[model samples]
Structure formats: C-alpha cells, structure tokens
Target: MITELKNIKKSFGSTDVLKGIDLTIEDGEFVAIVGPSGCGKTTLLKILAGFERPTSGELLMDDALMNRVPPEQRNISLVFQSFALWPHMKVKEQVAFPLKHHRFVSEAFKKQPDVRVEEMLSAMSMSHLADRYPHELSGGQKQRVAIARALSPAPALILMDEPLSSLDAKLRIELRYEIQKIHRQFKKAIVYVTHDQGEALAMADKIVVMNAGKIEQIGTPQEIYYYPETPFVADFVGKANLLEGTWDNDQFSPALSPNVSWHFPKVSTSFKQAGLCPLRPEQLKPTADNQHGIEVEIQNVQFQGREMIYTALANETQLTIVSDADTRIQIGERLLVGT
Candidate 1:
C-alpha cells in the first residue's frame, strides 16, 4: 500500500496541531517519524489510521482518497504503546480475534483461525504460552502477543506508535530486532512513530524529523545524521554543536578560531545564511596542533566503557567531544580541538 498525505492539516478549535503535513510511504517501506513531545507525530499517525480526520488535505492509498474512511474500513493494523489486549482473552485467542473480525483478513486466515493463530504465535515465540492470559504473561510476552495479533490478519500496512516505550531498555532492544524481522518477513509498509532518535536511526529506512508541528527534514538515517539541513535536525538527531562562523562560499571560518577554515560545500543555505556550522561530537577531536585547531579548556569528563565524553569551553562557548577512553586529559587542561 502506497500511502500519501498532501497538505494535511489538523486543528483543535484555536490551536493547530498539524500544520500542513506532506509525506509518502512506499510499498513495503519502513518509515519512522521522530520528534519531541507535542510535535504532532501521534496525531499524524491517528490521521493515517482513520481515527482522526484531516481538517484540509488529501489522504490517498494507492491513489484512492480515504480521508473520510473509518478505522475499520482501512486495510491497516495499529499496534499501540499500551498493549490494548483483553484481559480475559488468552494469547491464542488474542491472535485469533483479528483473523476472525478484521475486514481485510485473508480467506485462508478466516477459514482456519486456529491454525493461523498457532502460526502467528509460533513466529513470535509465544506458542508455549498460548494459553496464558495477559495478566499471567511478562511485559515482553504481552507485547509479543500484541504484535502477533496485529500481524495475524495480514494487513497491507502496520502502524506502530511507540510500541516499545513501555519496556525496559534491554527488552526494547530485543523488540526492535523482532519488529525489523517481522517487517522483512511480512513485506508490509510500516509507519512507526517514536521520540527516540536511536530507534529511528537503527530501524527506519526513511526518517522524518518533525518539530513544532512541522517537518524539519526527511531522509535516510545516514543523510539525516551526516548532513542535517537545519539546526534543529542537527541538534535533535545527532547532538551536533552549532558554532558561530563566517561563510565565504564553501569555506567557513569559525569565530573562535579565525585561522581555521573548513570547506563544506554540502551545507544547506540556511546554515550558511545564519553564519553557523553544525559539527557532531564525533567530528571534532583534541589535538596539539594549535595552528590548525581551536583552543578549548576541558571542563568535565565522563567515562563510558569504550569512550570518553568531554565537555569543553572555547571562548566561553561550550562544546562536547567524544574521545578515546585511553586518552589522558584532565579537567581544566587546555587542548586544541580540530576536525
């Protein structure tokens, strides 16, 4: 299912939640929408799932308009963050419910719901606990059952709204891989909504970064991380430090380091116009070469297992740099930072 939204706008009386959203989801593509709270990502997902109507714009599925269609009429499955499973229904029955009641269920699934339910539960590794109720299962197992139920009917598109947010960090990682495997095996288009940048980077084929009810940028993970078009995207997605600079065509001279000039041709015009350069923490390194680097004073250090995070100050401007764990740099020490 190729889903497209054109000039979609949503308003709640005086407040505008979605200010003209334009996006497309290709067939079998995994797209993740990431942004901070109240960025309208969840509202957008609701619009796609037919739970909310757009104030003005076209919602198209395979070139057919579906703005007025109800949630049950749309050939889509939604997996919620809260795991909306019935307490009385067992795992197998939960999986079987969709196959029996969904409007888009396959003939084979409807003909033999028990077999389909068993197959779905087996795929999710919940076959052994098929008789357990939601309250009897662990959090991970309950979410797995929810996923199995969503996938049982074989919908054309799957919409997930922070399905892993309620789990622990380790369990979240486990479910991310599971979701990826399911997407690959089912070949269904998935529109995932989350605020975690790492989740979008790790799982999404295409990433949409939204801010203040508007899309800041849309690209692949590498493109969004390496070549951010806006300052918000740079800071939000990659934790980039935006330095004050003067741009002379492709060359940029930092205000703090006047002698150092970097040639960046791919930087967007907005950054150049603002006389700023965005550099990620990993892009800058400490060096002793004063002539080619900016001088900074190390203020603090945090030691992780494999790397060290340093907070440094250059001309009163704070900066963050990731360095090797073995490098011996003390607090209040002056160091030259260069790309």
Candidate 2:
C-alpha cells in the first residue's frame, strides 16, 4: 500500500465530521470518495493532504506515520475545485513553482526545472499557453495548468477536491479523459473527492461511498452499482428503488403486494434484516399481465433520446422506472409493473 488511513476520526467541537474512516490506496490507484454534502468527503481529503489532523488513529505513508506532518513536508499535491492558480504567474511559472519550492523535489528536476516544466506543460497540452496569465486563460485551461503543476513534482500521492466541479458540462467530460490519460502516463496514486456520482463512476477504479460521516461501502464501480451492501449505497450510488419487503430464504415478498415474491440469493444480510429489496430502474418493467406483478399508477414521464424515465406510485410508495423510448405509457395510466 502507498497510503493507509486507520480508524481515522475527526471532529470540530461537538460536530463529528469523519467517524472511523479506514482506507488504503495502492500505488497508481485512482480512488474516488463520493457522498452527499456534509458527508465529510472534503474533510477526509483535507486530512489526507495534511491540512487537518485527525482526532485519533494512525495515518501511514510508506509505512511511516504522517498524522502530525505538515502539508509542505508531505510528498503530496492538492488540486482544489476553484483552480487555485496564481493570478500573477504565467502558465510556465505555475508549473515550475513546485520544483523550485517543494522540499521533496528530486535532484534531476531541481537541476533542470525548465525542462521539467516544459514536459509537464506538454503532458497537459498547456504548452501553447505557456506565457499566458490566469486571467488570459479559460477555465479549462486554468484547471489544466493546475493539474500540470500538481504533476510536475512527481508526488507519491495526489489529492483532488472536486477538480472538475467548476467547469461546464462539456469541459468536464473532456477533462475527465485528460485526467485519466495523465494518470495512466504518470502512474501516480490519486485520492479524488467529488459529489458527482457520474464522474466517480466513469473515472475511478475504486469507489468509496459515504453518508452521515461514515463509509457506506467501498468497491469497484461495478460492485458498488450492481451489488450494494447497504440500502444507503443502493439508493445513493445506483439510485435503486428500495421496496419494503419480507424475506423467506432467497425469496422476497414486497409489502405492497404480498402475493409477489422475488428470488434473489445474493442480497446482503443487512438488506434482508431490514426487510428491504432494491430494484434498479431498468429492472422494473411494465407488463400487461396483471396476476404476476405490482399494481402501479404512472405519475410522470420523461422522454430522453434513447430511453424514457418514469415516476410511478404503488400503494403510496413512489418508484422510478426506465424503459426504452418506444414503450410509451401515458401519465395517470394504471399498469402492472414487474421485474
């Protein structure tokens, strides 16, 4: 492991921000920490960047303790949401700043700062705007410069706090590919904190879901989406419609329609104990057969280019379902919905 956070907890007065966070980042791994607002994702990122000390527990970097280490002393780089570039410095100067000032800068970089800066600018495709100031560059360019600067020092780890949150939708998508390219080229471990689940799902190798100051689940994107261990993970990550249900072995009978039983052998025990069954939006299908499904009323419909999204009600419970564009169901229409 390159970095390890063991039982990490943090609080400000009576408000506990992070409660017993334990995570490990392997070398060159892209780990995304995602959660709703005030879920301590940023706080956890700050702790990793050494901006805040943990209340208790150990932080290890390369097997050495880093709990009380200063941000400047640690071999870590941070890229913030606001694109914290120096307004006075040009692009080249911003990329060169770390090599000139960082204590952990290698001898090769220190001896040839100009060459290193050029290479970083080229890597981020910012060489064309080398002399441009922050005011002269677009938002995406400024972010690219910031990323180049972060990578210039060749830090052991990089901590990014919503780096693409300020960009437009198109620019965000473009930068996602850019970031992933550099990650592959440089092989640096990243601890990314973001509120956008789509970004986390698209870019991260591993996803950490958090809620109410605790980690809900940690797994690969497929695992987190396909097999959520908690109701919160199911609802938050995959937007799975959780149905109140009772379990009998591998079969589940939803409370709304006791006659309907679903056989799912792989559900987590926590969900079974809570008497809940999570069904994804695509899993619920509208069927003409009335005997083998739950009765629901279509409340709303949204037509995308390829698919239609539906808001439905069954026994006072609201559910979301997705279907192909060709399957049109008018609002307020009664239908039988089944898996």
Candidate 3:
C-alpha cells in the first residue's frame, strides 16, 4: 500500500466526524471518496495530508508511522474546489511558488522540476498564457493552473476536494478528460473527494461510499453500480428505478400496480420479504412484442437532443424510458414495458 489509514476517528466537541475510517490506497490508483454534504470526506483527506491529526488512529506512508508530520512534509498535494491561485502572480510564478518556498535546492542541480514547469503548462494547454496573471484567466484556465501547480511539486499523492465543481458542466466534462490523462502520464495516486456521483463514476478506479462520517462500502465503479451492497450504495451511485417486490420461491413479485413478476436464477439460500429491485432506466425498455412487459400509456415526451425521454404511467407509478431520437412516439400513446 502506498498509504494506509487505520481506525481513523475525529470528533468536534460533542458531535462525531469520521468514525473509524480504515482506508488503504494502492500506488497509482484513483480513489474517490463521496457522500452527502458534511459527511467528513474532506476531513479524511486532511488527515491523510497530515493537516489535522486524527483524534484516534494511525496513518502510515511506505510503512513508516506519520501521525504528527506537518502538511508540507507528507509528500501530499491538495487541489481545492476554489482555485487558490495568487491573483497577482503570473501562471509560471504561481506554479513555481511551492518549489521556491521549499527551497528544493534544485536551482543549481540538473534533472530537477525547473525543467518541469513548461512541460506541465504544455500538458494543461496553458503555455501560451504562462506570463498572464490569474485574474486574466478564465475559471477553467485558472483551475488548470491550480492543477498544474499541485502536480509541479512531484508529490506522491494528490488530494482533490471537489476540484471540478467550480467549472460549468461543459468545462467539467472537458477537464475530466485532462485530469485522467495527467494521471495516466504521471502515475500518481489520487484521493479525490466529491459530492457529485457522476464525477466519481467517471473518474474513479475504486469508490469509497461514505455516510454519517463512515465508509458504507468500497468497490470498483462497475461493482458498485451493478451490485450495490446496501440501500445507501444503491441510491447514491446512480439513478435507480426502485421497485418494491416480494420473493416467491424463484421469482420476484412486485407490490405495485401493473405488477411485475421477474424470475432470477435460483441460489443456495432463499430470501422472501419486502425488498427493492433497482433497475436502471435503460433496463426498462418499451417493446410492443413481449408477454412479460406491462402495458402502459405514454404520458409525456421530452425531446432532448441525441435522445428522447419517454415518461409513462402505470399502476400510478411514473416510469422513465430512455430511447434514441429515432424512437417515434406521441403523447398519450399506448406503449409496452419490459421490466
């Protein structure tokens, strides 16, 4: 493990924050910590960076105990949601600030990071504006500068706390590609914290689902998306169409109207109770030729470019169907659903 945290706990007066979080991050892995607001995700990052000592746990780096090290000595870099760039400094100067402050003793040595500034700027496509001040850059450009500065220090790990939340949707998408590219080229371990599920899904190799200041589950993106271990994980990862059902021997019998009867492959054990089946919107298709598909009425048609969202009503339940733009359907038309 590149970084290991054991039985980490933090509390503020009477309220508890981060109740015993044990996380181990491997080298070159992208681990995203996500949860609702005030869930202590950022606090965990701070602990890893040695910013705040854990009220009760041990942190290890390369098998060396480091519970009381200062933030700068931990070989960790933090990138914040707000691009905390010096407004008066130019891009190159802002990026070089860390090296200058540390007096890295590389000014007189070759094969040092002084040669890395231009490369970092070029990687982020900010070389043309290297001499420009932070105030002269756009929000996206300023964020790139912040990222460049963080990577310039050659830290072993980088902590991102909602770093892309400040950009607009388009820029967020654009920078996600850039961030992934940088990760591939640099091969540095990253611990990203974000409340946005989509960002976590898009960027993380492993996701740490947190709730109430503790980890709910940790798994790969696909594992978490398809087989969520708990209701919280099911609800947090993606858009799930939850249907209450009762297990009957080898099948699931739904409780709602337009009742669904789905059969699953038999398992070693049996569970029969009121449970939820999380179906993705894409799983429920509208086809006119199936016996298992329920009959419903098309309530609305939203023409979003590239795809059309078909909303239907059945058994007093609203169902959303995602189809390509070529799907021809009118409002109030009849449709069939295959659960």
Candidate 4:
C-alpha cells in the first residue's frame, strides 16, 4: 500500500470529524474520497497531505510513519477545488513555485525525470496559456494550469479536492477526460476529494464513499453505482428510487399498497431487511425485456430530445425512467413499468 491510515481520528473543538478511518490505498491507484458537505472529506485530505495533525491514530506511507512529517517533506502534492494560483505570478512561475520555495536545485533536478514545467503545460494542453495571467484565462484554462502546476514535479501522490467544481458543466466533463489522460501519463497514486457523485463515478479507479466522517462504502464505480453496500451509498451515490421492501427468495416485495415487489437477479451485498431497495431511473421502465414488470400510471413525460425521462406513479411511489420508446404520455394514463 502506498498510503495507509490505521484507526485515524480527528476532532475540532468538540466535534469529532474522522472516526477510525482505516484505509489502504494502492500505489498508482486513482482513489476518490466522496461525501456530503461537512463530512470531513477535506479534513481527511488535509491529514493525509500532512497539513493537519490527527488527534490520534497513525498514518503511514509505505510503512513509514507520516504523522511526524511536515507537509512539503511528505512529498505529496495537493490540488484544491479553487485554483489557488498566484494572481501576480506568470504560469511558469506558478508551476515552478514548489521548486523555488525550497531552492533544491541539483544536477539530477536539472536533468529531471519525464516531468518539467514546459512538459506539464504540454500535458495539460496549457502551453499557450503559460504566458497569460490568471485573470486573463477562462475557468477551465485556469483549472488546467493549476493541475499542470500540481503535476509539474511528478510527486508520488496527488490530492485533488474537487478541482473541476469551478468549471462549467461542459468544461468539467471535458477536463475529466484530460485528468484521466494525465493520470495514465503519470501513473501516480491520487487521493481525490469531491461531493459530486458523477465526478467521482467518472474519474475514480476506486471510490471511498464517506458519510458523517465514516466510510460507508469503498469500491469501483460499477460496484458503488450498481451494488451499493449501504443505505447512504445507495441514496447518495446517484439518483435512486428507494422502494421500501422485504426480501424473500432473492426477491423483494415493496411495501406499496398494490402488492408491489421485484425479483432481482442477484442480492445486494448489504441487503438490510425491510430497508430501502434502490432502483436507478434506467431500471424502472414502461416495458421490461423480461417477464418481471410493474404496473404504474404515467405521471409526467419530459421530452429531452434524445432519451426522454418518463415519470410514473405506482401505488403512491414515484418512479423516474430514462427511455427512448415512442410513447406519448398523458397525465393519468396507466403504464407497466419494470425491468
């Protein structure tokens, strides 16, 4: 493991934020720490980056104790949600800030590895913007420059705290691909922090889902999305229609009045009894490819051009569906919805 936290705990005044955060992150793996606001995602990141000292427990990087190590001495880089670039400095100066801070120049530093200030800009496609000031650049451009600066030294690990949150939706999507490209290019371990589930799902090799300072679930995007291990994970990870149900024979009978139930092909790993059974919008459809289906009333049909989102009401339970079926929906019309 590149980074390991054993029984990690932290508190501020009276509120205990991180509670026994035991995690093992692999080398060169892209990991994301995600949760709602005030969930200590940033606090955990700070602790790992050696910015904040944990009140108790131990942190190890490759089995070396890190609780005593200083921030820069830890040799890890952090990229924040806000592009914390200097307004006065040029792009090259910003990229070279860390190197200049310590004044650690050597023959090997001059000859370096694959990473350089120019190469970092080239990698992020921000070479032209290198001469431009921060105010002159677009939000996406500034974010790219920030990422370029972070990756300039090729640190062993990089911490990203919602680095794409400042960008527009289109730019966020575009930069996500670029970040992945850079991750592959560097093959460095990453500890990313974000609240946006879509961003976490898109970028993370493995996701560490947090809730109220505790880790709810940790898995790949597919595992976290399709096989949510907790109620929080099921609800928070994505848009899920929670159907209150009871399990029987690898199936669930939802507590809806019209004797509603679903026979899932497989059981969830953490299928708590009489709890919420999550179904994504795509799962509940007007027509099922198989025998299992639910009867519902078409509540609303939103014309989204490509794949339309259909809303249906079934036994007082509202269901949303993303489908491409050529079905004109009236408010009170009945429809069979299942999958």
Q: Of the candidates shown, which would achieve the greatest TM-score relative to the real structure?
A: 1
User: Per the 3 Å backbone cut-off, how many clashing residue pairs does candidate 1 have?
Assistant: 0
Question: What is the alpha-carbon lDDT of model 3 when measured against the actual structure?
Answer: 0.82
Q: What is the lDDT of residue 50 in candidate 3?
A: 78
lDDT of 1 by residue, 191-293 (tens): 9999889999999999999998899999999999989999999999969989998999989899998889877888989899999999989888877777668
lDDT of 4 by residue, 124-221 (tens): 88877778889998888888888887776667788998898877889989999999999999998999898889988999999999989899989999
- Find the candidate with the highest lDDT and give its number: 2
Where in model 4 is the C-alpha error above 4 Å?
Answer: 102-107, 111-115, 257-261, 288-291, 325-328
Whichever of 1 and 4 has more lDDT, that candidate is 1
Kindly report which residue stretches of model 3 are placed more than 4 angstroms away from their true locations once superposed: 102-113, 248-250, 257-260, 263-274, 288-291
Candidate 3, residues 1-339, lDDT tens digits: the string is 399999999998888998999989998999999999888998888888778888998899999888998886777778989999887899988877776654232453224555678878988999999999988999999999999988886678889989999889999999999999999999989999999999899999999999999998898998888767666777688866666667767676666632567765531131234366666666777765544666778888999899888888867877777778888789998767775
For candidate 2, the per-residue lDDT at 156 reads 89
Query: Given candidate 2, what's the lDDT at residue 239?
Result: 81
What's the lDDT for candidate 4?
0.82
**Residue 231 alpha-carbon offset, candidate 2, angstroms:** 1.3
Clashing pairs in 1: none
